[model samples]
Target chain A: MFKLIKQLTSLVAVIAVLFAFTTESMAAKKSKTLKNTQKKGFVRCGVSQGLPGFSNADAAGNWTGVDVDVCRAVAAAVLGDANKVKFTPLSAKERFTALTSGEIDILSRNTTWTLSRDADIGLTFVGVNFYDGQGFMVRKSSGITSTSQFKDGTSACTNIGTTTELNMRDFFNSKGISYEPVAFEKADEVVAAYDAGRCDTYTTDKSGLAAQRTKLSNPDDHIVLPETISKEPLGPVVRQGDSVWEDIVRWSLNVMIEAEEYGVNSANADAMKTSENPAIKRLVGAEGELGAAFGLDNEWSLRIIKQVGNYGESYKRNIADTGILPDRGPNELWTKGGILYVPPAR
Target chain B: MNFKLNKIIPQLVTLLVVVLIFGFFAFNAQINMDNRGIEFGFGFLTQESSFDVQFSLIDYDGSHSYARAYLVGLLNTLLVAFIGIIISTILGVIVGIARLSPNYLIERTAAVYVEFFRNVPLLLQIFFWYFAALRALPLPQDSEPILGFSYLTIKGLYTPSFVWENLNIFFYSIIAAIISIVVIKNYAKKLQENQGKQLPVFSISIGLLIILPLLTFLTGGVSLDFEIPVLKQLSTTGFIYEGGLSIPPELIALTLALSLYTATFIAECVRAGIQGISKGQKEAAASIGLTPNQILKLVIMPQALRIIIPPTTNQYLNLTKNSSLAAAIAYPDLVLVFAGTALMQTGRAIEIVSITMLTYLSISLSISLLMNWYNKKIAIKEK
Candidate 1:
């Protein structure tokens, strides 16, 4: 009996010791995601499962979109290699949880920077990359030119748990027009339902409309209405309480925008390093100790521009040139009548 | 004494280990949540949901609380389960009996049905119904009226609903009729047992049920008006039905898949129960010179039902739990509305998941308890 008791006590002690060691190590690892990411030699980026011109994969499994560019830019800035990124495709419903649970280091999934998501979900939105607004798409044969022409009992299909649903309700109620919202969890379902005539209209971001329109059987049959209902400043996101990691992601995006503002394209980025412009010198790490502030190398911005190009190049190549959404209404640099402005790198 | 000590000590140590592991998990979760600065509470249940459900049984809007949204989801789930249970039972009994038929075609047909539906995954079946089959339906403007009153469109099935007047008085009449019938049935049963006298209790009960409700319509000012659906054009091409009850295609697809899938299992259970009965029992009934109907009602069925019911009740419970698959096709059941959308909106993973789990657990427990009571009532007594 004494032997059994001693053995049991020793087993319990051994397990307790192991548990304590694991918990202690986990606590130590939790505080330094940047270091862990560096050690892993890749940044795990959470992206949308498939949204063309935003974050979509091709037949060859190569991910390329505006959101995908943000991930590559971050990888270029942090690891000095644009290919040092692993994209984990996530649905809108699981995006925040995945980031908060440390399943992914950054969520560049074209997620909206909503107040509740920022304040309540333990996530921090870096900055807006795509300034979009919710719009409606209807068949051209419907003869509904504007949103005002939508009468009572019009049914609209949209994705559930998105700002689109709330915007649809608010738009109809504010206009005194009663409409039914047929919501689905997945984006593909919404498109399928709309195509099947299960709904009279479809509601989503204007960019989403353009991207998803390509999937429709007759893309030319649909028209996006002119009225923009809600502002969706889609941006990258990071877990809260890690100011260092948050700054790394935020500045990586800002570098791209600033690169465009400084007239720095991928073609001229290497030659522009020797230019006499103070802001250009600071951006390319030819002057100043700005990179030390975010614990990155001095040539972080230069690597980003060289690997992923400026914001204008990414937007044009992935969005405009692809004919998914050719309009760059408000995404151009602030100097050229748009809102793509960022703080100076100093 | 040593043997007893050994057993008790090991059990106590195992209990301590389980408790310690649970405590360790709770402690880690708390620390992790604290580190992330996420507050844990159920206070958000009373907050405005600010999210609209496409199809809800109750009067719900975005202004309602999350608690109310939960109720709407719970009610929708219960509705699917209730409808699925009724349809599956009827189909199951028919197919089960058909499988035992002497006719070759009927037996093969029953076998084919069981083999087909039972092998396919429920989620895929739901997808096939919601996406492929229902999508083939016509638009509202192009839809042909069924029986000149209802319309079936890709949007939904619009059926004529009754606008009832004096509904409470009609309900009271029904209750009164049921009570009187029950009293009469007890007296008749006593008369037969004590004096060998019988009464037409079944016919009398049916007569009361119909007459009581009919009398309310005539004398109590109870009226019902049918409102048929009418197509209204919003634009050149947009059309929708007005003034009727619209059953969304999600509900139809969900219930159809659930019932068809569950009926296969129930049919197998019924087949097993019937086959378990001995041929001697049938011959023994014939020897007593009883009629075919009497032998079936008093001998075979009563015994077969004793075996059939327990497994059938298990299938009913399975059907209820499987209704969670409604989330896949966006039917807005408890799992979709409360767990999927609400959890995403609130970002309270622990609270929302636990509540959803507990709700399903309670539903399953209550149903099993009811089935146990029914099984006890139908169980044979040995004297």
Candidate 2:
């Protein structure tokens, strides 16, 4: 009886081990099955929740921002209507999980594309939409002039799934300063900590610091440091191994940048359809197979540029020239000496 | 034989059904994983993790393997769990005694505390502490020095870092005290049993504990020092404190919420424990000429602990498991560091998540196992 019971227990343990091994294989398999099911209709796009310039929903629940425009451009290319895309709002912690879990088709959130993220984390960054860098925001009364003056001290903030925390450490360490990081889980908490004098300085992507500074009680009392400490090439990311879907996302961004370079706004895109310029002609679907390469319609690029406007238009309307009025410094087209460049369509 | 067969046949059928279904799943999974480019193995655990953690109880970096990251996360989780359990136990006992106090105000105050914290969701409470309450703290530079050397800022509480020399000798001294206490307890018990005379075992134990540890400092060359935090300026007005060890805000919020929330349940267990002893037992002890302290130590506590321990152990287990909610606050606990960031990095979601769940399960199981053994040892014997 003792030997039988021992055998039974070992068998049960083996079964449990097998059960666990199967579950993971099941998750990977299920993801592939989902790819087939998600071939048509509206593509689900994961976006940021209420970041003013990048991705924010309106009072009417309409999504609008530079990131939002990227998703809509993809939707226009794939499903014909720019509005067909579903915008699933995600927090910084939830964004990557939602994408990898196949809860969303495209993640157009203002995510930074880093080496670890691109190579180590199993996600492919399509392209850069916003070039950002880490900066510090401090109250004017603090008399802090630059990041170098901060020294080894306290910082009030939270960061996404990357080396922002490690970067902060390195930045201070390089200067031989030791700091106590008062990191929180959300942007709102970071702001509150700063406002309530919990920490003397708030650090984040320069764009986020700018957006947060505007919400301060005395906005003028704060200064964004002139020093841009870290390179933050913010862009959209997708799950790796899906090249077909990757091309659609990649080209959707490319069309926007190309549109901006060709001066093709939503209003002028329709009239410029018959233009003699080869690049504009190709973009408007009058001269090239750019749309066909992505399994999209010939007028896919046209509809995107016409419906959502160009990259420059999207930026100005949402973040820059609009109420936020974020300065378009390096975000200008490559032809205009800025780094917002796209590869040639041909 | 026929009657036994009727019972045995159904059990056999049910077992067969379970096995078959499990087999089918296993077979299908083997095929599916093979179809994809993904390979199933634990080899990835030893490969370089190439990811950094913010707060770790153990040394770790990107250069470490996934196994090392797991260790870092596990240690942090255990550290938080141990700290929370200790704090909650002390608070619980006090509140539990206060509830039964003759003073109406103290009784009502303890009751109010129990109701306020126990009724709220743990996650929301963690958020409120981390997001709203802790956020109101002063910046490191602007922070007022606490006890002359420590700084409590919005970033986290900073205390003077303890630099200990010859720590092993100090530790050995404490171990020696513990061994002496056990030996004293046994001798006292034997003396009571054989001669019907009891030694003041508690006082003797306390004396040994203090003297042995003091001897370590005097003769063992054990020494300690503190590194205090100082304020420094960065960029125009940015002020920060440097030098001292900083406890990140997440750890603070987690401990505060976990302890406060679990204390209520523990208090209830304590109250139930003391209330379980019959009034007749207490009266009989007093009639027998036993003092109040003697009655408690000899009669009341023995019975009360029988009722208290099982439930208290369950609460401890619950607290350990719930510490996984550290993921929500980015505390880099086991689930957050391993199942979260590492899973994203390796794309081995299956392995990472299972390891996380199993880690929590084992902790819960081990505590339960210990509790079961204690319960068995203390169970009432019947003739």
Q: Which structure among the candidates has the greatest DockQ?
A: 1
Candidate 1, A118: how far from true, in Å? 1.1
RMSD for all candidates, in order, please: 7.1, 11.0
The numbered model that scores best in TM-score is 1
- In the range A246-283, model 1's lDDT, one tens digit per residue, is 88889889989998988998999888879999899888
- DockQ-derived CAPRI band for the predicted complex in model 1: medium
Model 1 segments more than 4 A misplaced: A1-31, B1-8, B191-201
| Ten contiguous residues with the weakest lDDT in model 2 chain B | B29-38
Candidate 2's DockQ: 0.20
User: TM-scores across all candidates?
Assistant: 0.93, 0.84
